[model samples]
Target: MAITDEFLPVPVPESLSATYLVPTARGSGAKPAEAVAALGERLSDPVGDLALQMIDSPLMTVDTRPVSQFPELPPDLLAAFGATPGQLEQLRTANELVVVQAGYRPGWPPVHEWSARAVAAAIAQSLDGDLIDVFSLQFLDPATALRSLPDNDGRLRLVDWILVPYSPTDTGLWFTTKGLRRFGLLELQAQEVPAQFTRAWGAIMTGAARRLLRIWTESLTEQDVPAFVQLPIETTVTGHDIAVAYGSPERHDSAGSAGLRLDLDPATDPDADSFLTLLPPAGQAAAPAEYFAQICTRLFGSGQPEIRYTRPSDAMARAVETARRSLRSARDRFLIGGLPPGVQLVVKYGLATDEGQEFVWASVTSWSNPGRIVATSTSDAASDPTVRVGTPVVVETADVVDWALLDGRGVIEGGWTQAVLDERL
Candidate 1:
C-alpha cells in the first residue's frame, strides 16, 4: 500500500487557500508580473510587487488578497515567475498550501501568494534535478523510532529504517523514492482537488521520508528546523507471574500423569503466549502437551482462564516485592526457574543507590548435584561471577525484572530460571 494511506492530511481553511506555486525560473514557463501587466486594462487592482515570506520550512506564505500583500519584491523573485492573468488568479485559490506558525514569532504574518510561488522556485533551483523529478513531497507527523533489518549474514543491519510509533500529529513532508513506476510522482498525479491533494499529502509522509523532508526544509527553504530525535518507548510484552497449581486426579485421571499446571501471569512473565496457556512447567512433565491438556481440564475446569498481563513498568514494583520477601527469611527464596543455560540477568537496585539497574549474565557451571547458578559480567576465567546461592522456593513466584536470557551462542532470547542450591543438591 502507498505510504499516504497511513496518515491524515491537514484540513483546509475556508477563508483563504494555500497552494504550491512555481515560477518561470523554477521552470514553470510563465511570468507572474508580465501576466499581470498583460491584463493592464483588465487589472482590477494596482500592480504590486509579489512578496513571499516563509511561514515555516516547506510551507511558504502566500498573499491571496486580490490587493497585493507586498509593496515590493527583489528583482530576482519578480524576474523568476511568468504567468498568465488567469494562471495568477488560479494560484490565489489553490488549496495545496499548509498552514504553519511563524518560527520564533507569534502571529501568522501576511503570506504572499506570489511569494509562495517564489519559494517553490527557489526549491526547484536548489534541489538536485533527479530529486525534484523523482520524488513528490507531503508533510507528516514526527517519527519516534527505527527498527533495523538483518543483513545477508543474519546479523541485524541498520538499513532503511521505518518508524511506526503511531503518532497522529501532522508535522512535515516526505518525498518518496519508491513507487515511481506504480504510483508516479504523487503531487503531479493526484487529482487537483482538496480530497486528492490531501490523499497525496498523506501518502508521502512515511517515517522513511522524514530525513529527506528535513534536508529539503533546511537546505532549500533556508530554515534551521530542529532535528528529529527518537524517544525510547518500551512496548514489548514483559509482564508475567509464575505459579504451580495442581489438578484433581479424579477430574483429570482419564489421560494424564501428575496433573501439575504452570500458570504464568502478565505482570511477571516475559513470555506470555506459552505461559498464558497454563502449560505444565517446562521440564517438569515427561510429556508437556499431554500433561497440560489433562491438567488444564482440572485447573481451568471447562472455561478459558481470564489472565491480566502486567506492563513493563510493573517490573520494578514486582521485583521489589520479591526481594523484600526473600530477604525477610533465609529459608524462603523467591524461585524463578525454567531458564536455559547461558542466560543473562540484571539486578535493579530500587531506592538503594544512585546506580541504575546493573546488567549481569548467567552461566550454569555445573548441571550435576548442587549445580552452581552464576550471574556476573562475563564468564571469562579472569572475571569473578556471582554464585546465586540464595534461598529457593518450591514454586516459581520470585519477582525478577531487567533480566534477559542469552542462548549459548550469545543471542538474547528471554527470561531466566532460579533453582535453589539445596533442591538441586
Candidate 2:
C-alpha cells in the first residue's frame, strides 16, 4: 500500500472569472505621483525597472478610466496588472495606500476587470520576480475579498495555497493567501492534499511519505507467518469421603482403604492427528512425543514419581519411634521439631524483671492434645523435663495424606503433611 492511496488530491477547476474596482485618486492630488515614486524605488532592479517603464509608457495608461476590458492575458501577467487582497491590506495598514469610498454596480464585470489590471501593476512594482512568473489576481465572492491564482510556469506555481476573507461588516475588506510554492506545486498535490489547504505544501508531502513507509512495513510483517507447537494433558480423580475410627479391634486388625470413581473425557485427550488438524501444516514436522516432553518440562519437572510401601505394623512402629526421638531432641536443644525443613523458630531470652528470674524454659505445645508434648526446667532439677504424648491426629489418606491435629477447642495452631514438607522433614 502507498500513502497516496490513503489521501486524495486537491481538485483544480478548468476556468475561473471574477471582477475588481479601482479606487479614485484622492483630492490632495499626490496619489498618482506617489504611486509612480514607489514604482521608481523598485525600478532600480532590472526586471522591476522594465515593468515600471512599461507601465509609465503612453501605450499603458490609455484611458485612465475606472473600468476597462483587456483580452486573453496570460495568467501570470495578472500579477503584474493587479494586487491581491494581501498586498492591498499591507499597503493600507502601512499607510502607503489609502481607501476611498467608491460606487459600483452590484454585479458589474467591467469594474472587476479594470481592478485586476491595477492589481497586476502593483504586484509587478513590488515583487522582484519577472511578470511572466507570478500569480493571477481575482475577486472573491460576496465582494469583500481577493484571491491569487498561480500561472502554469513550473517556476511560478504556488502549491496548496487558499485564501479566505472574513468581514463582519460591509464597510471593511480583508484577504489572505496560502503562500508561494517553495517546492513543486504539482508534486506536492500528488502527495496528500492537506485537510486544511492553508498548510505548507511541503509538510503535506513529508506526511504522505511517512504514511507510505508505515503501510509497507505493516504489509511485510503480515506476510511472515508465525510458528507454534501444541501438547495436551487430561487427567481426573474422583472419590467418596468416609470416617474411620481407631481403637476398634476389627478395624485395627485390617488395613484401611477408600473407594474412588474416575471418568476421562476422550475429546480432552485427542491423538496426534487430531492435534495437527488445528495447527499449520508447516509446524507438523516435529514428533508428538517430542512436543509432549517439551510441554512436560515446561510445566512439570522431568522427575518421575517413586512409590514404595512398608508393612502397616512396621510403618506404624517407625512413625512412633521418629516422633519420640523428635520430642527428645526438642528438649535437649530447646529448639522445636529438630528445626523442621524451611521452618524458622526463633527463641530470645532475657532476665525476668521480678521474682521468677532464676529459671529459663521453653516448650512445644500441640493442638491434638493441649499437653501432647511439654518441656520445661524446674528450679531444683538438673535438666529440662521432656514428655511425648499421643492424641487422635485427623489423617486424610488418599492419593495424598493431609493430616491436621486440633485441640478440644477445634483450633489448629500449626501442622504440615504436604508431600513436599514430608520430603524435607
Candidate 3:
C-alpha cells in the first residue's frame, strides 16, 4: 500500500497535550559536569527556539536564584518562566505562545534511582501530570507506565485515548484497570530509498504509528482469545464405486480403529431422495464387501475412531460435481497442517502452457502415522511441460515419520488409506 495516500493530515485538536520524558545519565568515561555541559550545549539553541515558539506573555520574574551576585536571568527568560494565569489568558487571546520551566535539586536516594526518579518527576511536573511507578526493572513496564487520574468520586478514570511510542525491544504495550493487560508492539524502519520517496516514507511512518495506536487500544476489548482444539475434515467420492481407509490410531480403547469406507454422501447435509438415485446399481461390481469388513476390523483393532460414509443429498452431490469440474483444469496446490504433526502439501503438474514450462519440483513434509490426507495431486498439480513420473512422489519413514512426496507428472490423490506397509517392510 502507498503510505503517502494512507496518511493524510488530520485537524489538530485545540487542547493538544503531550508529555516529553527525557533521561540523562553519566556515561562510563564522562564526568557529570562534562555530561551536563554537553547536554546544555546540544539543547541550548533548540530550547531557545522552543521557548520563543511556546512562551510569549507579560508576567513577573520570580527568580529564586541567589540575589547576591547575579540578581536574575535575562528579562525575556524570566518573563517566559514566570507567566501568570492572567498573562497566559491575555497571550492566548492574542494567539501568543507561553511555556514554563522550573528547576530543582537533582537529588536521589541512589545515583541510578535518582536518575530514573528525576527524569520521571521532571516529565510529570512539566505537564502537571501524575508519576506512575514501574516495579519491573525492564525498560518499559506497562503496569506502572502511566495511569489516568481518578474521576469525580475517586473512581479510576479512563481517558478517551492515549498516544504511545512503539518499542521494538518489548512485546507490544500493556496496561491495567483491574490488573495488567499487554498489547502487541510494532516496529517500523525506513530503508534508503530515492529522494523522490521522502514524502512516501514520512507517510509510512505516520500510518504505522496510527495503526499501532489503534491496535493497542482495541486489544482491550477483543473477544477471540487463543485456545487449541482439533478441527475435523471429511472426504467422499461420488458417481463411482470407491474405497476409503483410515490410518490413525484411536484415543480410547472403546473407540473404533481407523479405516476407510465407500461414502455415497460425504457431506453432512444430504438430500434423502435425490441421493438414493446416485448410489451404485444394486448387485453392480463394487470393491468386495470383505474389503470393508477388513477395514472395520483393522480400525477396531487399533482402537481408532470409526470412519463413516453416508449417502449425500442431491443438492450437495451436484455442488461437489460442479466444484470438481471447475477445478479440473487448475493444478498447483498448497496445504497447511495444524498442531504438531505438522503436515504440509504442495503439488505442481507438468503440462505445456503459453506462459512457461516447469519440470522439476520437490517437497518436504512430516506427519503422524495416521495423519489425515490434507491434499492431493489432481487438485493441486499445475499445468507445465516438464512432466516426469515416479519423481519420488511420496517418502515415508518409521522412526521420525518425516516424509516427502513429489511428482513431475500432474497426478496425486490419496487420503484415509490403510497403512501401506510396516516400517520394517
Candidate 4:
C-alpha cells in the first residue's frame, strides 16, 4: 500500500507536543563533527525535499554499515533502483551516513515529499557517490502492526509485533520480542518488493521515531509483560514512562495529570520501575481474571499467588526483567535465527482436580495445526524435557515456552528453555 497523508508526519498542535525525525547521513571518511556542520548547512538554506524549521541533535555513531551489507539482495531489487550491484556497493561503503534526528516545527511538509530514496540520493550526490536506494530502521506502527495479529481463542500464542533496538553495526531488520526470530512478523527489509513499486520513502522515515516510541510503549503495557520481573530498584529515576503516556490522542487518558507525567511514577515508587525507566504494564481491563490467574500460575505455580505490585522481592523483579529481556534477545538472534525443521515445542500445562492441582512440562514432537494441534510425546528426555504423564496434551504457540532462566549458558545452547518453569516452582 502507498503511504498517503495518513502515513505522513502528523501536524503538531501548539497545545500538544510532537517531534519530527529524518534519517540524516554523511560519507564514511567524513568526521562525525561534519554531521553537526551539515545540520547547520541544511538549516541555513532549508533546501531539500524536506524543509526544516527546527532540527534536533543528531544520533551520531560510527557503528553503522551502509545498505550494501543486506544479505542476498536480489538482482531485480537492484535493477528497480536503476543501479548495478557494483555501483551500489561502491556508494554504500563510501557513504557511511549518520542518521540525524530533528525536532520538526508546525506545518512541516508531509514526508512523502522527502522520501528515503531522495534523502539517500541527496546524501550520495553530496559525497560524490552513486545514487542508490538506502535502507534505514523503522518500527512498525502499532495500529498498523497489531491489525495483522490473529485474534486468540484464550490460548497464548505468537503475537505480531516488532520491538527493534537500533544497532548501527547490524544491517538486518530485527523484531526484538518474544517467540523465536524465525517467527518474526516485521521483516520488512527482507520482503520481495515488486519491480514497479514506488516506495513512500520520506513518509516512512518521518514516521519511524514516532512508531518506535509507540512500539516501546506497547511492549511495556503488554499484559503479563515479563520485563517487569527483572527491573532493579533505582535510588534515582532516569527514563521516561513510555507506557500509558504513549498513543494517539484518542488513546490518551488526560492532558495534564501527575500519573500521566513521564518521570514521576518510577521516581517516587520502586515498584513502578522499568529498567529503562518505563512504567510497568498497567493491568488490562479487557483481560479476564482467569487469564491473569493462568499467567500467575505459569510463572509462580498453582493457587495463583497474588504477585505483590509494590516493593516486590529482588528475585521476583529480576526474574520478570530476565524473562522480558530474554524474549527480546531471542528476537535479536534473527541475524542467525529461523525454524529450520525438527524443532520441538515444549509446554508447561496445569491439570486441576478435586484432589488438588499439579503442573507438568511436556514436549510435542512433529507438531502441526490445521485447525487445532494434536499432541504426542516421543519420550526422549534430551531432545525434549521429560514429562511425567504418558498422555499427550495440546497447547498454543510453541514459542511461548518460559525463557526467564535462559541466560549465559542458554544463549550458548541456542534453544528454548523450561528454565523459568524449573526455577519458579
Candidate 5:
C-alpha cells in the first residue's frame, strides 16, 4: 500500500545532527572546516553535499564546542559498546566536540543521514577521533561510520535511534524516539505495554517513528498544522497489506479503547521530550486484543491467531541443515567481533511441540559456542498458542534451523533456509 499522510501543525526538523568527540591532541585530525569542506568531495551524490545544503534549511555547519577539561568515560557505556583502551583514552582526553548538521532532506530512506554520517566519519578519520550518534546513542569508529550505504540498507540504523526500554518495576515498557526529533517531531513514548509484547512493540514502535518521519518529511505545506493528526501506518501482514490509524496521543472522548493511549507532549514540557503509545483507528468495530493479535501474527509469524506452514520441502529441509552446518563460522565471527551497532543476530530454533516442532526466531545474546547460544524469542508461538513472546531460550546447535547475521542496512550472512525459503516457499 502507498504511504499516505495527514497535515499537522508541528515544527519542521531544521537539520540532521551528529557529534564527533575530538581528542585534545587533534593528532593529524583535519580541522572541522577542512573535514566538512572535503566531505562533499569524498562522497558521491545521493549521500553527498546535499546533507549540508537541502532546501528550506541552512548550509551544513561544523562548529567546535570546546570543553575545558575532558571527563572520564562512563563505565557502562565503555563496557556496553566494547570500547578499546585507545578509544577510551581518546574519549577521556577529548577536548572538544564537533557538531555537524545538514539541512533536512525529508524523504524516503533518510539518505541524508548517511551524508551526516560520512562527514562525521571523515573528520574523525582525519582527526583520530570517535563518533557518537547523538540521537541513536550508537558509537562508531571511523571505519564503521565510513561504511555508509546510499540506499535503504541504512534504515537498520533507525532501530537504534529508538530507545525501547521495558521495565518490570514500572509495569511499563517505554519507547523514546529521541532521534525523530532531528526531524522536528516531538519525541514519542509508549507506557503500560505488557512485558509479553515488548519484543513485538520494539519493532512496531520503531516502524511508527520511521513512518512519522517519512510522513512529516513529505508533508511540508504552509499551514499551522492541526492540533491532532491521524496516520495509517502500514506493514506486511501474512503476505497481505494492512494498517491501522495512529495519531497524537490526545485524551480520548470515550472510556473504552482497544488501542494505546496516544499522548502528544508539547515542546514546552519543562522536562525533556521522551514521552511515547498508539490507539488503533478512531472507530474500528473489532475488539482491541483480537485486532492487534492479528497484526502481531502477521509481523512476527506468531500471535494469538496464526497460520503455520508446518512442512518444509525436501530442498528446504536440506537448506535448513546447511544453516546448521555453517553455525560454527557465524559463532566464530560473534566470538571475535562481538555484536556491534547495526548488527542483529537471530537463530531459529526447532522446539518439540505436541503437534510437532515449532520453529521460532530468537534474538541471539551470546555465542558461548554453536551449541550453547543464549537468546530471547522474537515472537509468540508460531503454531502453538500456548507459547509466549519474550521467552528466554537456550539454543542448542542440534536444533538450529538457521542463523542470520544482519549487519547494518541491507547486508546479511547465513540463514541458508531463509535464502531458499523466499524462493521455494
Candidate 6:
C-alpha cells in the first residue's frame, strides 16, 4: 500500500526489532536453549510464525571470544536518557553482555510486537537483567516490561507499540512518535504546534495507525484524511476534522525514520483539539484519549486508584501572556481570522474566583468598543451549572482571556487555551 492524499499507508518496515542489553546473563552462563524453552512454555497457544522464527534462529547471543563487548552510550547521553549512575556503571563495564533480540518479518505487527517484546522481556526476567525502550529513553526491569499474551478473544493492546512525546529541539518544538516503526508503520509527528496539542496528537497519531490498518484489512479505497480533526461534537466520523502529510525526517536527530506529520496549519488545528476523529462512517464515536486510557488501565492497573491530574507547569503560564498579546489581532480580524469566509467567532472570557481563574468559550452575539456581546454558550463547560449550552446569558467581557475564530470550514485562529489545557492533561 502507498500513502495517498486521502489515506495514509502503513509501509512494511525495512527492519523490525526489540533490542535489550542484558548484563551478567550470558557471562554468568545462561543458555539460549533454556530461554527459548521457557518462552514456548509460557505461551498459551501453539507456536505460530513468530515462534517458528524464534525456534529456528538464535534469540540471545554474547561474544564467545575473549574480547569484551557491550552497548556503548556516553555518560551525559545516558544521564539525559534518565539512566542512574548505577545503570551506567553496569552497562559500561559488564563483560558478559547478552543482547536479547526479537526480529520479525514484514507481514505482522501486533503479534510480532507482542511476541518479540514478550520473548525479549521474558528472557531478561529469567536472567534477572534489565531492558531499555531505546526511543522513549527508558530503562526497565524485566517484570515491568513483560506483557500478558493475547487472551481467548485475540485482543491485543495496540497502544503499547506507539508513543508520542512533546519533543522540543533547538530549532523548533515538535510532537513525534517513538514506536510506530516497530509495526513497520511510519512514526507520526506534528511540527510547531502548541504544547497542549501534544496530548491530542497522542490519540490522533495512534488512531491513524489503527485507521490505516483497518483500511488495509478491509481492502478499502483511499479515504481522505480530515483537513482538521476535531474532538467530535459527537462520535460521528466527519472526514474534515483532521489531516497529516506523509514525509521524511526533517531533523538530523530523528533516527531517520519515515513520518506522518499532522497538518496543524495555523487556522485549523489550533482549536480542533481532536475530540473524536477515529470513528468510521456512522460508527459509534470512540475518543482515542478515552479509549487508550481504558486500554492502559486494563493492562497496567495494580487495582490502586490512579492519580490523574497535576497542576499546570510554568510553561503553561507563559502561554497566557502570549495569548493576551494576540488578543488585539483577534479583535482586528473579528469576523474572519484573516484565513476566512468567516464561519464563526467565539471569544474566551476568563472567570476568576477564590480558587483560580477559568476561561470560557462563548459565541459573539454583539460587539462593543472593547467588549463582545456573546450569546448562549456553544458549550456547557461554565462553572455556573445554569449556563448550559443554549442558555441565553448576555455575557459582558470584562476580562477577555483569549479567543478563537473559525473560518467556513472550521479552520481556527487564536485558541491558546488548547495548548495551555494540554499541560494539565
Among these predictions, the greatest TM-score belongs to 5
lDDT of 2 by residue, 1-425 (tens): 12242222221222222222232233112243244346443222333333344345432331232212322333343433344655444323331222211122212121222233333434333332112112224322211221222122211111212222111111111112221111111111111111111122122223222222222223323323212111111111111001111112232212222111111112354531110111111333433222322222222233111222222344444543443334433334423334322121111111223333222211122213323322111011112122101111211111111122222122132222223334544
Q: What Cα-based lDDT does every candidate model obtain?
A: 0.24, 0.24, 0.24, 0.27, 0.52, 0.45
Q: Using alpha carbons, what is the TM-score of model 5? A: 0.51
82-192 in candidate 1: lDDT tens per residue?
223443433343333221111121112223322332333333233211101101122111110001112123221111222111111111111123321111111111111
**Could you tell me which 10 consecutive residues in candidate 2 have the lowest summed lDDT?**
237-246
State every prediction's TM-score relative to the real structure: 0.15, 0.19, 0.18, 0.23, 0.51, 0.46
When summed lDDT is taken over every stretch of 10 residues in candidate 4, the lowest stretch is: 189-198
Best by lDDT: 5
TM-score for candidate 3: 0.18
Model 1 residue-pair collision total: 35
lDDT of 3 by residue, 1-425 (tens): 12242222121111112221211121122122232233332223433233233323221111111123322223342233333444333222321111112221111111222233223433333323323222211121112322222222322211112221211111111111111111222222322111111222222233233333343334323234222111111212211111110111132232332222211222355642111011122343433222222232333221111122223345434543443343222222322322111122332222234544322222322223232321211111245222212122332211111122222221133211111222113
* Model 5 regions lying over 4 Å from their true place: 1-20, 24-29, 32-42, 51-58, 63-66, 69-86, 99-115, 148-157, 160-163, 169-172, 221-268, 274-276, 282-294, 303-425
For model 3, what is the C-alpha lDDT against the true structure? Answer: 0.24
Superposed by TM-score, candidate 1 places the C-alpha of residue 122 at a distance from the truth, in angstroms, of 5.8
Which residue segments of model 1 deviate by more than 4 Å?
Answer: 1-12, 15-425
Among all windows of 10 consecutive residues in model 5, the one with the lowest summed lDDT is 236-245
Regions of candidate 3 where Cα sits further than 4 Å from its true position: 1-9, 21-38, 48-425
